[model samples]
Target: MKFIDEAIIQVVAGKGGDGAASFRREKFIPKGGPSGGDGGHGGSIYAIADRNINTLVDYRFARLHRAKKGENGRGSDCYGKGADDIVLRMPVGTVITNAATGEAVADLERHEQKVLLAKGGAGGLGNLHFKSSTNRAPRQFTFGEPGEELELKLELKVLADVGLLGMPNAGKSTLIRAVSAARPKVADYPFTTMHPNLGMVRVDQNRSFVMADIPGLIEGAAEGAGLGHRFLKHLTRTRLLLHIVDMAPLDENIDPVREAKAIVKELGKYDESLYQKPRWLVLNKVDLLPENEREKICKKFIRSLGWKGKSFTISALSGEGCKALTYAIMEHLEQESGIGNEEQIT
Candidate 1:
């Protein structure tokens, strides 16, 4: 299935029914008084978060959504029935906003979460409600109000504990495959991953975390080389970031340190908060270097980049140093969360 994360839609709530005015005229005791029933309320529109749904493709095709109108009131004290409500199921990470006013409406993080998108109008009043001593035979009835309508924009941001950041073909996909069961297409080319891919890495029996891999970010990406928002939006939902640097690029002319710096610069330009998130450096493809020079080369690159944070040297394809990396990530996430390490996310 093609992954679609963005969509726009229009929602219209049902209109309320009109009130009724009547008089009781039976074959018994002359005039009894007003005997009108109230109108039923209109149907409302609601949204629910479904974990089973990972894409917004369905909403892309069906852009307009409307609810049913309520029934009108009858004359012989017969109250009308209210219409059923409409529920829209969307992905768990979906965020809904008012397209016109740029106001945020909802951020669905948990499964089975529901929020109201449009409110239904209230029911109209009946003539029986206006009965009094002076106006016993009154013929007053209030009209129902109109339902609410809105244009909304839905954006899905994938939720993960860790996110991978790097240049094109920096071994992110290979690293994810080594750590988890996700098998994203890998090739000897750039932009192999056009969409985001998620993998679940388990360190122990019950200890696991989700990792996300997005398309490679280039030097001019923030200005327009790529849709800056689309590329970096998924990282905002992550708790940690892994900056994967290709310690051994196939092209001898390419500077790994320069490419790494460019990647971080683009990240900061896209979102400052995302740039401020906890990040660790992973020098990938150490197998390409000689075992004796591995430590020296990795140390030199980290030093030249002025990086003083957590660092690791790993061969993403050979599974070397992958286990230690996953364990460290699991520990960091657990420590930051201040909870048990057994809770799993979908």
Candidate 2:
């Protein structure tokens, strides 16, 4: 299925049924009173979150949704039938916003979460309700009320514990595949991953965390360069970030250190809070380097960059040093008091 993270749609609730204006004319009773019944209420519109869905691709083709209208009232004290409510199922972690007011209406984070988008109109009164002692043979009925309509914007942000950040072809996809069950497209060229992919990385028998592999960031990613800000917003929900750098670059034109610095700068420019998140430096493709020089090269890069936090050297392709990296991530995630705690994190 094609990945679609954003969508726009219009929702309309059902209208109420009209009242009847009639009087009973029985054979035995010559002076019969009004016998019109009340009208039924209209159907409402609702949005529900489904964990099975991962994208907003369904809304891409169908943008408009409307509920059925209530049936009109009939004579002889017959009430109209109420319309059925319309329910729209969306992916978990969907943020709904009102297009006209530019306000966030709801953020569905849990499975089976539901929110009311539009309300149906109330039913109108029938002629029998207006028949009183003074007005016995009255023929007064009211029309049905109109339903509410609005335009909405839906945006999906993947829920994860760790987010992978790197330049194009930095072995992020490979690392995720090696650690988790996710099978993203892999190739020698850049921009092979155009959408975000999520996987569950298990550190131990009972301990595990979700990881998200976002699209590669370019030098001017903060300024909407290359793939732009669509993928950058996905990192906001992550508790930790892993900066993947190509230790042995296939292209002689690319500088690993320079590319790493550019990515950091872009991240700070986009959101300062992103820089404050717990981060780890990962050097990938170490298998391509000479065995004796790998340790020395890794130390030299760390010192040159003036990095004080944790760092790891691994080969994502050969799965060398992947277990240690996963354990380190699990340790870091557990150290933070509320990082993985369900009650505190949301």
Candidate 3:
């Protein structure tokens, strides 16, 4: 299935049926009273969060959603049949907003969570309700209320424990493939990843964390440059960020220190809170360099970039230091359980 994170749709609730205006005329009876039946209630529109769904592709193609209208009332005090509600199943972590009003409608973060998108119109009163001592034999009847119509925007954010951030061809996908079952496209080129790919990194049978590797960033990413913040926004839900730097770039012109600094600047420009997330340095492709020069280059770049957090050297292709990295991430996740921005991602 295609991964669609954003979509726009129009939702319309059902309209109620009109009230009936009738009078009974029985045999051998001089006069008869009003026996109008009330209209049935209209159907409502509801959005339900489903764990089985992971994308908003369904809403992308089907832009309009309408509920069923209520049945009309009948004579002889027979009430109309109520329309069934229309329930729309959406992916968990879907955020719904009113397009015209620019207001948030609901955030379906958990599985089986539901939110009312549009309310059904109420049924009108029948002629019997207006029958009183002074208003006998009345023929008063009311029309049904109109249902609500709204244009909505839906956005889906991936729920993950760790996010990988780096420049293009920084071995983010390779690292994920080495540690998890997700196999994203890998090649000896820049911009190989076009979309975000998620992986389940398992430290053991029971200990694991969800990791997301989004499209790589470049300089001026915040200003709509080179895939821009379209992929960067996915990192907002992650608790930890692994800033991977290509220590051994095949292109000699690309300086590791400068590129790392550019990634940091772009992240800060995109979102300050994302920039402030718990970020650790992961110098990738270490095996490509001589063992003697690995430590020197890592230290020099860390010093030049003024990085104060923990750092590691790993070769995503050779699986070097991947175990330690995954172990450390799992340990950090355990220690930070229920701490920081740890939301329940069902």
Give per-residue lDDT, candidate 1, residue 71.
77
Task: Please list the residue runs of candidate 3 whose C-alpha ends up more than 4 Å from where it truly belongs after superposition.
Answer: 338-346
| Per-residue accuracy of model 3 over 1-346 as CA lDDT, tens digit each | 7678899999999888888998888897657888888888888999999989988999999999988877777778887777889899998878899999989999998999989999988887789889999999989988777889999999888888999999999999999999999999999998898888999998999889999998889898899889737878788999999999998889999888999999999988989999899999999998988888878878888899998899999999999999999999988887688532454442
Best by TM-score: 1
Give the per-residue lDDT digits (tens) of candidate 1, residues 58-107.
99999999987777777878777888899999999999999999899999
Give the per-residue lDDT of model 2 (tens digit) for 1-346.
9999999999999898889888888999887889887777788999999999999999989999998777778889998998899999999889999999999988999999999998887777789999888999888998778788989999998899999999999999999999999999999998899999999999889889999999899998888887736787888899999999999989889878889889999999999998788899999999998999999989998887888988999999999999999998887788674556764556
Alpha-carbon deviation at 306 in model 3, angstroms: 0.4
Better of 1 and 3 by TM-score: 1
TM-score list, all predictions: 0.95, 0.91, 0.95
> Residue 176's C-alpha lDDT in candidate 3?
98
Model 1: worst 10 consecutive residues (lDDT sum): 337-346
| TM-score for predicted model 1 compared with the true structure | 0.95
Please identify model 2 stretches exceeding 4 Å from their true place.
337-346
| Selected candidate, larger TM-score, 1 vs 2 | 1
Candidate 3, residue 310: how far the Cα is off, in Å: 1.3
